[model samples]
Target: MASDVIVRFDNILALDNFSVSIPRGVVGLLGPNGAGKSTFIKTILGLVEPVSGDIDIVGLDPRKDVMSIRDRVGYMPEHDCLVDSMSGLEMVTYFGRLSGMTKEDSIPRSHEVLDFVGLGEERYRPTASYSTGMKQRVKLAQAIVHDPSILFLDEPTNGMDPLGREEMLELIGKIAASDKSILVSSHILQDMEKVCQYVIIIDNGRSVAQGTMASLLDQDMTKRRMTVRGSPKSLQTFSEQIHRDFEETSISEEFGQMNIVFINDGSFAMILDMAKGHDVQVRSYVPDRLTLEDVFIRSMKRDA
Candidate 1:
């Protein structure tokens, strides 16, 4: 957790009164480039000293207890920080040892984590020989080799293909299920939506929005939107009826489907009744909700 955190570099501010109370779960850290997400992480890791503010990681102060914090935290950096000469197993084992694990413990633990990240036999190959996805997996393996209680994953799915990205997200979900607190930073909003229970959106080095995924997306409850599918003629008749009653309603049609948005006071039951009266066999009627991308864009615009 951080409060009133301020960090500057040679007159350029990186964190301007930035503050956030991250909950214990898989939380997404979202921002545009240069929004200070990486700087925030570094400050928490004690790699960047804030000019003013207090920061606590799991109860210990990063300023005074950085060593202790490192022992309990795992960090998968956004950029590649691999030693090309080292094999996957060797690289992970080295990080484990650095995390204070004994050789006896680090070796097997390295293999276990490597397997968890799907490196398996590839663990024997040099990291330079691995593909981008494999390299990303190996990076994750090293981060968790010591079994830290907290994880900071920066762009964990960078360079991964569709299947690979899905697999990475699944791994993150499993980790969250284990109760280990994770803070993930990714440009991919969809991936964050799939795994994050909470999200903090930042811009210009300031906290713009932070909340539970559902709460953030459902902030505007006054407007109701839904998609309806029916025959073209039936849909047109239904649309006309809705417009006649709810003058403020907006409807767009494409390929025998209609996307409708109206004031929440307009009842969905009434719409269904109109459909029935118009002899429209509603094939599908589903509520449309705001997505993480929608929330992120809105937050950035509001902050701007």
Candidate 2:
């Protein structure tokens, strides 16, 4: 939605030359703390104006088509934003009305969204009495009360137990499975991997990576990790021989298992033949697919 966008707060530039077009799907916004993620979201919501460049929120300019952007888009901020005195229904209904829904329509829609978010019974209870998970549910309910086409979910599973985190991630997966497109921002790489088809990685106010999740994580297909189960002595001897024979290879042994990384091993058949001849038991071997966390670290270090 932005092209060469530069957003600044006072003297600090939050987004520099940020040019990216979001496709229609669930996308992840990943970055470390203070990586200009919030600033970027605010700029799209029209809360922060770009110092120089244009913004198109779902085809409507945020400057001239404020209402269109406001109506079609939904946002659930990272921190707690619920009104303690208001019940879930009241809060969601209020946001629904703010989205241009009539009072009568807002009430039913609010209940529907609260129920959809697994908070139907808690809709009437005051938010102050709710747990962290319930509060998150309320926030999610309010964001979707108006049935927006796109949602900006910032840390939807910020503080929760394992079960709660899983539930929230599953709920997000369900939402993304529907027609609604979501831009989910979080530091939790596992949750992002679960729900996101595409990823946008940012660091220090600049985008370091953006592409399909599979393509980004599996960028280098030639290199791979191989695990072989065998005796320590056998694996040790095997490892030494391979290390001396192959270029750009490292082997580590632990608990009678061998972990090998082919940094740039060019020949798969030759390596397999060598291992077979050395009597190295092959437990499993597959092309290396870097985890999201690995990709984030490598990308940040590369950019740095």
Candidate 3:
């Protein structure tokens, strides 16, 4: 696990063991509120040192080589720290210079990053006059001004409307495509679901699950559940016939639908064929794919 690993927090054994590997590309650090996701990141960034165990970012010990790690890592903190008098470009340039960028390089790179984050025209506007979404973009621009290889984003979608969220997700996806690894910590499972291929779930400071979406959801008994509506009585009759003939079908009280669990990973074609043969006249059939929410709920149940 340590091979090709950029960050590792091994067996702290606190409430959360804090162990997971963040490979290249976009990986989500998913958890509910107070799940210690932020704390774990802070510990890794050397902001909050761990009491026991070890942590390394980019093969450099975060504690011993804090400066080296900071140089190569971009962090967009969750809190709002924009200065009222500073323009977006100024703020970005300031951070860039602080990160060791010379004035000549900082000025142009500030525009490049602000433009990359969709703040080109408004780069000169004071941050205090910016909207919430604009402020978020400013923070993002500053984080990437130094051109870090890794980005640690804390709730990048926070306070964003639906459109803003989508735009932010697209931007994050572009960053991932451009060869920078992103570790985004967020409580919003749906938002994270759209961007992350791999997820690391932590609960009460313990690593709950860490894998690809498919791998995490593979343990679910109900990987696919859908409701069919249009004619209640006909659906019920179809369901009853299926139950009477085949024992694999069960009625779901929650959704009031004929819930069928696939045995031995049966294909969807089987259900379609069964419906056609029975002359059920199904109005519609939809399959619900597994989501991060389902995996999180299952992990919570297992922990309980």
Candidate 4:
């Protein structure tokens, strides 16, 4: 958790009065490049000192209890931080010991986490010879080898193919299932939507929006939008008929659909009646809900 945090690099400001109460769940940290997401994570880990404000990790002050915080936190950084000569098993075991685990405990734990990340026999191979996905998996193995209570995963799925990305996300889901608080930072919005229960969007080094996924996406529920399908001519007539009644209406004949923003839920029934009157045999009707990408774009534009 952080309150009124401000971090500056000489003349450049990286964090501008940023504040967030990260909940105990899989929370997504979303922002474009240079938006202070990585800096925020480093500040919480005590790797980057803030010029002002307080930072707490699981009830301990990051400034005063950084060493203690490291023991309870696992960080999987975005860039490559692997030893070329060490095998996957050796690297993870080394990090486990660094996290204060006994060599005896670190060995088996490393193997367990390596297996959890699907390294298998590859764990014995040198990391230098491993593929990008393997390297990412090895990085994950090292981070969780000590079984920390919280995880900071910065671009955990970076540089991986689609299958590898899905596998990494599945692993993250499993970690969250065990009740570990995870803060994931990545450019991939769809992946964030799949895993994150709460999301925080940052822009211009400031907090743009932060809340549960459902709440953030449903903030404008009063303006209902839905998609309708029918024959082009009938759909056109239906759109023209309803255009004057609704406050806002849009029809895309190219897609054979219409979008309407209505005042109340009752308007849906009225729409169905209008469709019937216009001879528009509706094939399908579904609510067009806002996605994480939509929320991110809107927030960034508003901040700009």
In terms of TM-score, the best-performing candidate is 2
**Per-model CA lDDT versus the true structure:** 0.89, 0.84, 0.76, 0.87
Provide the clashing-pair count of each candidate structure: 0, 0, 2, 0
Deviating ranges (above 4 Å) for candidate 2:
229-252, 273-280
What is candidate 3's lDDT per residue for 1-304, written digit by digit as tens? Answer: 1222122347534334467777888899877777777777777677776665667677888779988888988999898989889999999999999999999999999999888889867888899999889989999999999999989999898898899899999999998998998999887889888898888887777777889866775654443453454345656666666566553423563344445532224666776666665555444445545568877886787766
lDDT of 2 at 19: 74
Q: How far is candidate 3 from the true structure (C-alpha RMSD, Å)?
A: 5.0
Off by over 4 Å in 4: 223-266, 269-283
Q: Among all windows of ten consecutive residues in candidate 3, which has the lowest summed lDDT?
A: 1-10
lDDT string for model 2 (1-304, tens) is 7788898888888898887778778899998988889988888888888888887776788778877887888899999999999998899999899898999999988988888888867788899999999999998988988888889999999897889889888888888777887999998899999889999999888889999999988887766778887666667777787677654345677888888876544666776776787778777667777788878888899989
List of clashing residue pairs for candidate 2: none
lDDT of 1 by residue, 1-304 (tens): 8999999999999999999999988999999999999999999889999999999888999899999998989999999889999999999999999999999999999988888988878889899999999999998989899888999999999999999999999999988888899999999999999999999999989999999999998886656676777878888878777777764346898887788776556566776787788877555555557779878988998998
Q: Which wins on TM-score, candidate 1 or candidate 2?
A: 2
Question: lDDT value for candidate 2?
Answer: 0.84
Candidate numbers, best lDDT first, in rank order: 1, 4, 2, 3
Give candidate 4's error at residue 205 in angstroms.
1.5
